[model samples]
Target: MPYRHTIGSRTYRFDDLKTLLARASPLRSGDVLAGVAAATYEERVAAQFALAEVPLRAFLNEALVPYEEDEVTRLIIDMHDATAFASVSHFTVGQLRDWLLSEAADAEALQALAPGLTPEMVAAVSKLMRNQELIGVARRCEVVTRFRNTLGLRGRLATRLQPNHPTDDPRGIAASLVDGLLYGSGDAVIGINPATDNPKAVSNLLHMLDAVREQYAIPTQTCVLCHVTTALQLIEQKTPVDLTFQSIAGTEAANASFGISLSVLQEAWEATLALNRGTVGQDVMYFETGQGSALSANAHHGLDQQTCEARAYAVARRFRPLLVNSVVGFIGPEYLYDGKQIIRAALEDHFCGKVLGLPMGVDVCYTNHAEADQDDMDTLLTLLGVAGCNFIMGIPGADDIMLNYQSTSFHDALYVRQVLGLRPAPEFEAWLQQQGIFDEHGLLPASTSSQLLKQLPPALR
Candidate 1:
């Protein structure tokens, strides 16, 4: 079913929401003031999605003048008792720029205030803020470095294969991996969350990937992205556990889903290190996260989803994961809600994680049950490509068998790189050229990749 946006017994529906977006009228100052004043938080958020950013920001600034002491003012900017900071609307674009660009800027205060605004408002604000503050905000936020420039290279983007299957069958899994690798993927990590969590099943999946990696002598890493405990179990049993996987959320309660705590993560980190797989040398954890995970687990910690996600990055940076990705909209529409929200959170998470000192990738994906589609993913991938994202999912035809959702495909990755003039991570790029899977430009068609594919074992072929 399409994700239900209804609050009560059918107060809203997919069509009604589409109508709301389609009918978004030109907004004015008084209308914004009155709407925020009278509407519930959910409705205000809906309005934020429907309204255009520049017009909404302009009118919100106008409304801020007369409604300084009102709830309406919170919509403009949640001061949150930052009393020295008067109404944000009072600051000119240049003054705001000075505050953001100046060394004395209160980054915590600025980030704290960000949750009150929509991504559109943030983007509109970005227009005035420009590169220095944008980069300053990115740095102050603590995005990890050399992520975009790993191996002393810049604009070197990356991609990974999900290689999921309905059955945890080795043959099925190998076929998917073959498809991804031949199409020029697996540069990020060939990590999989097996459909089944049985010990035998999980072990088999890991063994299969490790076998393929060794058989092909693939330089990239491999992982089974199950819960940390499962990975620990695999490691204890002497299976190949190259990376530890965990789902982290902003709040403690939400983290219960993965049964992880700071201590548990530390334990996994120590445990993985003790194995000394050293896919990247002491940086062997892979984490999956999204904006709505905290809320989905009913543990948002009283923060916005984006901020909650960033806090998860705090936990991620501790172990120094080689890959930390937000599945973006894969959790369904409840957290991200729609394409616009999904796109915004993708950019915000990438920017925030980069600042937080984590090598971050964006899974430009959405669940089939969610109110999003491939077109939305295209926009997100393009924007992330421009933003210098580290990686995106490269699944066959954008289909994830375990998660059963749509994501950027192998071809989609090629589309972005071709459009942006990006190449795969250096080692992977060299391998592709040697293998003839892709030229210096982009992925060859399957007929051409088949030239390399023919070299595989008959079963894999």
Candidate 2:
């Protein structure tokens, strides 16, 4: 049947189920909707069964053939809402078509038409489709899952234990936090530092990876991108840079030059993969731009949300066909410096959803406090949840400090967890104590204590 395929606000038409399934099957499962399709047909069916509480296997056996399109659409919608097909892999376009055709062709004559089509058999076929979907979804999911696994409630709490005072060892600080948050969690930690205008800084950042690996006791990788001339110098030196590019945010090279725009970011990323040459190391890269709301305000020109998103898409489109890795991330949503309302609106309006599309990661800079009122926090968080933000950065402190001292940063993180429903780490309480955030006397800081009282569950203020 002819149908329209929709991803967010964009839509495309397919001539038939075969055409639709083929296009949809391989379109990277970057968002929740695609993630569902990444699961096996049997698993998808099982998910539906779990939700609908109907014997899907029996229904398939009886209604495989001659099922109405409306009925199928309803079933698919129900399954989409109820199941977390994030990890499933096996279902495919061909399998879905075959299953539907098989079911619809002969309902009551199940035994005679396809006597061997047992639940296990169906599940196996679906698994094949899911595997294909995983080829696309895995990278996107990896980027988000890494952050989620690392920053469980316990991880957030533990950040307080570190010396609040700034240190010369930013990488060390990041590594330590990763180690604590992801302890007993076995995943690679990759860091990309774009903090220098010198090519040598890229080499310096690479050397720092060793420190992060040794200190954290986990595998690690780092990449550095120097501005245009510096990047060209590094390439001449054969420094094995992961990504080298023209700085798109403030330079004349990026202006009026598509080659220096997001396209260059993609080229640099592609170059990084070539440098790897099939090694088993993670690919890490970063793009440098100006600081504060300047980027957001002039995204297309100066690095605002729209321009950042466009660049990200360009990079994703280029790399997706090659590596299928999740090492790319966008930096600098400097909340402490940017206006609160502007940052919040940008995040909700475009950034989160845009990142999801490219299947990459976002690293928003945040203050060490919360500055907004409880009501505002609630509204912001609710909006973020709807926008599908996977990672957030900010200070770990009481609600009041976050609101008053660092309102933008504070509300951003709180909303990330409280409103968005991202799960906290299992050992979050211990981490909280180490930070001196919560005391034995139950004498919480007044700002935090007051907000806590206001947000208490109906039964236990």
Candidate 3:
């Protein structure tokens, strides 16, 4: 239990370094690694090399826990290795998409010729790709799934109904859920991240969503995106919890910022399981992560934000979350500056999260002050549609009043389905057809569709 490790080619004495990387979930060494993020580009590159050491340790020790084998080591090296981007850089996006569409094209050919190419590498290349080209490759990829588990993300892109309000009132929250479900967005889960940590507020939100889901007979999971301990307490109170929600990070300090430890997360998972409220097998945990989380907690060790994001997924795997998303642009311009940077980061997170074996979704959002617009999100959404993203957030009118950001709207969900020939979860689609919710053309019925809205508690009306 000493604060030292003689890892590959270097000796790390916890007393000697400044990053909490040694004390985090992925590392979780007894010593708290703390340091300022590297200030210069050269310092950052060095930091990336240093960050790779722990993952390399995890990879070699076969103690990556839930992850038997992941692409973290290769991805970390690929991120720093500029040569990985060279072979694919020559062709225009149009040329690349065409080749992928052609029968002679092989995905491996890019790697075979260039060496060290990975999906994350392609995601980086996506920075230069026009939206159409990025989407084209996604549509042709076979890994996209249409219907799996309680949620359907691939065959039809799914959306979470994030109806967060300032008061956590039943009427306001109910109104948002009605808006999303009527717009065809409850395929993922009606998850809410509370503005306050009050257990009563969270309990009211969960029970309220349960009432709404039952009324419409919508076959989807529901969650209150509070801390693990809050959720555990709700479960202790015998409240219905379909999925346990938590926000996680790559480093121990970042997780500590959220007041969660690996043991706390495991306890939450076990307690939720004992309740047996999930309809989606055993994968009942819901987790949210963003690229800037580590840096925000002052825990990043000068590593690239995307690599830190992937390390968070290592925490996610421990609980087998039913839903996992990189809140993408929601972290704003600091970690990823502007729309172009945000777009590339979104794709990179999705690619890396999927490769790490987690169900991946992007928040596709931005704050008012960030240099991003709806068009940028539309582009990311289109590309994610093809990449086979698992689920996306569906806020009322693409805005979160409580969180103060612009996210995808329910109409956006309908837009992706219409443009891409996608469908919802099989059972949910069956239910939709049963209720005539969407026609063969995937269009909602005319008017505000008061039928579903009328089902809300009468006091709201």
Which candidate ranks first by lDDT, i.e. highest?
Answer: 3
lDDT of 3 at 365: 88
lDDT per residue for candidate 2 within 229-339, as digits (tens), equals: 555556557665543433332222233242354445555555555565223332334332322222333322211222222323233333332111211112222322223
TM-score of 1: 0.71
Q: How does candidate 1 score on lDDT?
A: 0.63
Worst 10 residues of 1 by lDDT: 22-31
TM-score of each: 0.71, 0.38, 0.73
The Cα error of candidate 3 at residue 52, in Å, is 14
lDDT of 3 by residue, 1-461 (tens): 12344445755443222232322212111111223333333433333334333221222222221222333333234333345445544543334434545665443453242323333233223333444544454443322222123553347677888988877777788778776776777777778878788998888878877877777777777888887898898899998888888988876667888898778998998998787765546677888888778777876555435546766776776677778888988876666667776776677677555544567778988887788899988987877887777778899989899899998988888888888788777767776666657765675675635566545655366
Candidate 2 residue runs with Cα over 4 Å from true position: 1-195, 214-225, 228-263, 277-312, 319-340, 348-356, 360-382, 394-461
The residue-level lDDT of candidate 2 at 242 comes to 41
Q: Which window of 10 residues has the lowest lDDT sum in candidate 3?
A: 23-32
**Is 1 or 3 the stronger prediction by TM-score?**
3
Report the candidate with higher lDDT, 1 versus 2: 1
Q: Is candidate 1 or candidate 3 better by lDDT?
A: 3
